[model samples]
Target: MTDYVSTTPGLFPLPDWAKDDLSDLKGHQKHDLISGDEGEEITAAYEQARADVLEVQREADLDRVVEGQLRWDDMLAHPLAVHDAVETRGIVRYYDNNNFYREPVVTGDLEFDGDVAAELETVSELIDDDDDLQAVLPGPYSLFDLATDEHYGDDEEFLAAVGDFLAGELEAFPDHETLFLLEPSLVTDSPAEGLDELASEAIDTVAAATDADVVVQSYWGALEEKVHAHLLDADIDAVGYDFVSNQEDNLYNINEYGTADDISLGLVDGQNTLVEDPEAVRDRTDWVFDQLPVAEFDTVYLTTNTETFYLPYNKFEEKLAVLAEAASLAEVTPA
Candidate 1:
């Protein structure tokens, strides 16, 4: 029998208590207040929110759980944006989404300040088994693309620096089963001539820092041939494709390249309010297998195409159920 595991791309929507806490703190004060007694209160709120989201995932029967990234104000850029080496510039649009993030300007040599590792440490105590938990971090190339580089003049030099910084962060994280290196920028920006090779190298740098299996997940659209080929060559365990956002193109890419590694299919539309029919999702999964060379992978992860923070809390919960049910419908064999 094929074992089925369900997971999310992390960054869940803030719960009511977290929202209330944010409301009380207000504006720039939220960041300022986090260092004092108020910071303790806010920390308590985040912990509660994390616990609540974990309970929801457990109740939904998801095989793995994330810390919900309740404090990631800047989405994928939060970890780097909050670092001392980086400064927040003006607000900028976060890709195609309606949301925004404070642009991170690298003013000095980048260094891992242990913020993400500390956050993971807090969440690690809550989990019964480390194997059932997944940790998430923005991919190095995506971070380099998202930020403004002042310290390193050359693009390749800047990319390598960012990769080293991320590797340090990953090294600090508690042992867990998987690390998801979210790489939406690779898809959004497409592959440039030398960029794909640089990205693969940076990914290898970060992936080597941890014992956990690393999954480099690209969303927002399907990866083009060059980018897909580079990702396959990267030292990562699996590649995730966003089938919901770019179904036909992703299917075509998979058929053309034929993945040799494990695959994660993002079937549920995390950005949309519409809940998908499980039967339709099952059929889609079957079609994906048909396009593969061997019609099998070491593991198949059924997940959301992107972060579910776009959806209303109720809709997000419904989507998780849809993913779990769809995974149950998939045919699997032991690795």
Candidate 2:
């Protein structure tokens, strides 16, 4: 039987109490807090939120837990926008969704000043086992696609710079078992001509910085054949596909080109409120496995199609519970 691991790709919905606390906080206090600086009160609020989020995952008995990314107001651009070298410009729609993020405009040479290390540190303290901790970050290609480059003249140079900056940021992270590099843009807005090779190189650079198993998880849709091919060339443990959104195309790519030993299946719809039944999720897993040329996998991750930030906190928790139960059911299934 294949061992199924239930996990989330981080960026979870904030609980009601945390939302209330943040809403009541002074503007400057909230700014300082999310920007990596902190006051006693704001810090306490963030810590409480993180603790509560971790507890939810523990209750579900998931194999791995994420930091929940409760403080990321701007989503993927939050880390870059907060950096001194990057400027926050006009608002831009985040993919085809109604949500928007302040576009990160690179104005100076990019540098990492402990972007996600603090969040990881707090999470490490909350969990007993270090190996259970998972860190999620925006992939280099996604960051490049979303941002407006001003410092680097050439597109390839900017792409390489983004990769290097992210690698530097990862150097300071606390010990983690897995790293999920969220690369939605690779599917949402495919890379331009001749840039796929550079994009893969950037991904490899970031993957090399951490000892943890890396999964370059893309969402919204599956990549085109060529882009998918280049992505497979990266030195990474696994690749994630959004099965909920583009299942047929994703399966085609996987069956045609083949994938790594391990892969993540986004079995649940993250943006939707209706929770899936565990048996149904298990059935879906079985179907995906049967469709594959090779049914066996080293590890099959049952996760949401995208970050759960769009859903209510209760809904998010329910999805986690479903994934955990589904994984348990799959574990007992015969190979």
Candidate 3:
């Protein structure tokens, strides 16, 4: 029998209470060095949000629970956007969605500042089981595609630098069972000519840094044939496909070139507020398993096609319930 696990890709919506608290504290916000009252309050607000979201994941019986990236206000670029060496430029559309994030312009060599690792540390303290906790971060290729490079004029150099920087950051990450490397750009914007290998190499750099299982999760749409082949060539554990957007193309790619023993299935539609029924989700997952070239998988994750920050908090909570119930339903029958 195959193991089915339900998990989220992180970047959850801020709760209304946290939003209110942050709004009131933004006026009196202070820099990192200064420990002002407002800064303390802001930190408290985020901490509370993390705790609440963790509780939600626990209640839903998700196999892996994330902190929901409550502090990632700038979305995928939050780390680089706040880095000292990188400059936050004007806003850019995030994929084809209505959401937007500040474009990060690399003005110097990338360096690890422990932003994401610190988050893991905080969230790890709240989770009782280390194996149940998962950390999420932006992938190397996506960072290169989304950001502007002014220091390293060469594409290869910048990508390598970003990967090295992330490796350093991962070195400081807290203990966790899994790492979800978000690489939506791999689907939204394919790698440049001759850079696919380099992209996979960069991915290997960061993936090798952690002992946790690494999953290169792509979203928005299915990857191109060549891109899919190169991604499978990476030294990662599993590849997550966006079935909600282009299930047929994703399935075709899997049947053509095949996939890893373990895989992640994005069964929930994150962009839509409508929650899917558990029975339908179970049927779709079974159909996917039947379509696979092989009968058995080591592990199969049921996740959202993309970040659920676009949905209302209530809708997001409902989707989480759906995933947990769907995983239960899928696991009831042997593959």
Highest TM-score among the candidates is held by which one? Answer: 2
Predict model 1's lDDT versus the native. Answer: 0.83
| lDDT (tens digit, per residue) of candidate 1 on 277-331 | 8778888778777766666677788899898888888898888888777777664
Candidate 2 residue-wise lDDT, 1-107, digit = tens: 46688999899988999888777774657667546576788778888999999999999999899999887778987778788988887989988888889899999
Which candidate tops lDDT? 2
Model 2: colliding residue pairs: none
Better of 2 and 3 by lDDT: 2
Model 3, stretches more than 4 Å misplaced?
28-38
Deviation (Å) of 287 in candidate 1:
1.7
lDDT of 3 at 165: 88
Where is model 1 poorest over a 10-residue stretch in terms of lDDT?
31-40
lDDT of each: 0.83, 0.89, 0.87
Q: Which stretches of candidate 1 lie over 4 Å from their true place?
A: 27-38, 331-335
Put the candidates in TM-score order, highest first.
Answer: 2, 3, 1
Error of 1 at 218 (Å): 0.7
Pairs of residues clashing in candidate 3: none
